[model samples]
Target: MEVELKLLLSPADNDKLLQHPLIAAHARAPVRTQQLSARYFDTPDLHLLRHGAGLRVRKIDGTWMQTMKAGGSVQSGLHRRNEWEGPVDRPWPRLGKLRKLIGDQQQWLDVLAADDLKARLEPLFVVAVERHTWDLDVDGNHIELVLDHGHIERHGRHVPINEVELELKDGDPASLFAFALRLQEQVPLRLSNTNKAERGYMLCRQTGTVPCRAQGLQLAPDATAADARLAILNNCLQHIQRNETAVIEGDDAETLHQMRVGVRRLRSALKLFEAAAPCPPALLEDIVWLGTELGAARDWDVLLASTLAHIQATPGGRSGVLDLQALALKAAHAKRSEAAQALLSQRYTRLLLTMGCWMQQPAPEGLEEPAQDFANRIMKRLHKKLLKRAQRMDESEPASIHRTRIAAKRARYALEFFHSLYGGKALRTYLKTLSSTQEQLGSHNDLVVADRLLRELNQQHDAAAATIQFARGYLQALQTSRTPDLGAIRAALHALRLP
Candidate 1:
């Protein structure tokens, strides 16, 4: 297994990091510099990448080496993955040699030694860089820190690769984050979510990023509560990071929505485990700030798509509300820009790095309970509380119902995190009913937002006064007439069982 934390460095600060005092103070050996030029290979269609694998043959300091990295998870820029590396006699990869190194490991042997695979392999991109490395002893923990600076090239296109990788050699993983935090005091670094191989492929493919949905996680039946918590939180972070790319690289409102959902899911997961696995309240606060930023754009997006379209369908409403539509879209666009900038901000990177560090901490001894038992206890309490709150939706105002909606959403997120610990049929049905209730509440919540937004615009967009008045009146009437899905919410709560 390869355990490393990857960070991006500014080329201008490359020398700054090299001269950082800690690198020398904790150095176990003199820093070594090498010229590394690697040729990455895959099928024309990238079959290896599809299966979560990367293959490369590199010449480092005049010696050729072959390496394969596969099936890794990158969370908050920390990567944990399976790696197989060995010397090769020549510059080209010898598949048969790689298979022999597999040494009867059937899982990867089947992947590396497939018939006709070697023949189909083609060089995809070349990664050329100057790598300077150090073996360090920090508080008795052994680490290998390397700085690689150069570019990835395919055909005539290229992207710079100036990154620092801290690989755990013989110690605790937390030391890597600790050392990184110290280094950041002297030099600014961004936690790199993308590795060299992935970057090389991205350069080769020249593909655009789209919004990524929350990934599903499967917990072992025998897993511990700590295990489930770590897995789910990492999954949530991955969800947010993927959509972060979408928002940063593309112009899709859905990306913000999905990223907001990821934030909310993460918050709920932290609350669910608060008793056992507590996180710093400051971390939670930072996340709430992020959610608020994302929600601004998301609310406008919903108002434009759902409420405005409904008002547009009414008699003469199309011509009446046209100005409001333009105002809403303009507001949405502005908020989207702000949200994207938030992702690029230093505060955001600090939050991710801190959360990633927190994830590295070992679970408290008291919290090391079995997954199923802990899940049932936590879940039953959540279900009962939700049922109690939801039963009052029959008489509550939109404000109170909005509270219930928040509760339902949190409950829904918790249910997803624990889904793998229970049986399929009953949980699936409960989840479907719960989903329906949340969606229905969500639809109603849109009216609340639309009303507030239009009121704000009524104060600002003076040229569209009549249009704003019409839209606000339309949403006001809709909210006044709307009813909560008492039956479905109650049914969802009822269907949720203790097991």
Candidate 2:
């Protein structure tokens, strides 16, 4: 692969007016440069190739350009960049020809746009050099880097975060470290050595919200459909495991959210494969335990953050915002850090070990049922349990919504686990309803917890009760809104055709 250097500069750098502290100290710029290129290959179904490392995969359909790369390793935590190109109708047989067709293009760049129009953060940008690229799984996620240069195109995403450059190309560590130090002192910034993906994986795993993937393990039936299905399952498991670890370690909040996603994916996968590959009851119990624990932390975190943001955005709320925010921050950090550590302690280790052992055990046989028939049986059984749980909810009980929310989750998970076999428009429709139910309940639950935590924090910090009064009011309003949503959910649940 041919080599080139890359740098991420602030928009203010348009006049080359920016100065890094390290660069100023050294009388030189800390800007990074490297040589890199790649090419890609993939099946029509996007079966083998997906998105690049630490980047989100938008969908699974049509042609996805595989990436390959060879370049100077950068010192930063950045890994060599990989990419999954946009959708194409080209089939597997024509991949080489298609790649050759695009080989001579001059540039390639993908910019993830700002996530929100009015958000505080700047947009994120990712630039790539296209060359000989092959899409393959590395450590679970789809990876594509330079093989040979065909053409390079820069795609941009409008997101909330501003110019953050990840020197994914191989380069010098000293150079990267020097760059980081320079950036930190020169500007108000959150400098991260860890890429988004790794941190996210760790958070999920530590919190028990996601199942961790066991390394050095391989599934049988390599040539069969089971191999593909199993691979996805394991990927989800490992992602959750890593995310959980991150949470316990007090890594970034985004990591925790990603981990939650892994949990949901795994739960969904289990539901999808319920008939084709059923897990044991004991194993299911452990997975459920992991979900509840992680979900507790995740739910609270989201609720507090959102509510805090909501307050800050308002005029009256902003008047006493700093004081209230400081107290909220203190409480949030305490709960988050404490929860994280609790999940990673020896007790949690025992839980993980136990779950690992269970995964190693054999699952019940599929009883020779047709793949679809088997899948349906699993779905109906699981869905029935969800309905049973939902039925247990009582309007008189204070925690009734919370209990039913858990049921909604299980129902959604049941559908996800069986997606490979039972996945269809109908199943999707049912899951959509159940998912909305869970979200409504979850939002209410988050407000409750946030309110209590905010109040406690206020008392600890000697803040007046009136300052934190909004939290209580918010929680009550949330409850009232959810009451109707919950009813709608129950009605929709009855409309689902689980069988």
**lDDT at residue 139 of model 1 (Cα atoms):** 99
**Tens-place lDDT digits, model 1, residues 1-499:** 8999998878999999999999999998899998889999999989899888999999866789999988868876689988888899998888877887768778787777566888999999999999999999999999999999999999978898899999999998888888888888888887878889998888877877877898878999999988888888899999898888788767787888899999999888888888867779898889999999999989988888878898888886747587778888899889889998898777787788889888888786656788888888877777777787787774347766777777777777887888887766777777776787778888888888888998899899788888888777877787667766577677757767654
Off by over 4 Å in 1: 318-320, 394-396, 495-499
Worst 10 residues of 2 by lDDT: 145-154
| Cα TM-score of candidate 2 | 0.48
lDDT values, one for every candidate: 0.84, 0.47
Give the per-residue Cα lDDT of candidate 1 at 472: 79
Model 1: lDDT of residue 487: 78
Candidate 2 on 142-209: residue-level lDDT in tens?
22222221122213321111234423234332343344333434443322223333223333233333
For candidate 2, the per-residue lDDT at 434 reads: 82
Q: Against the true structure, candidate 2 has what lDDT?
A: 0.47
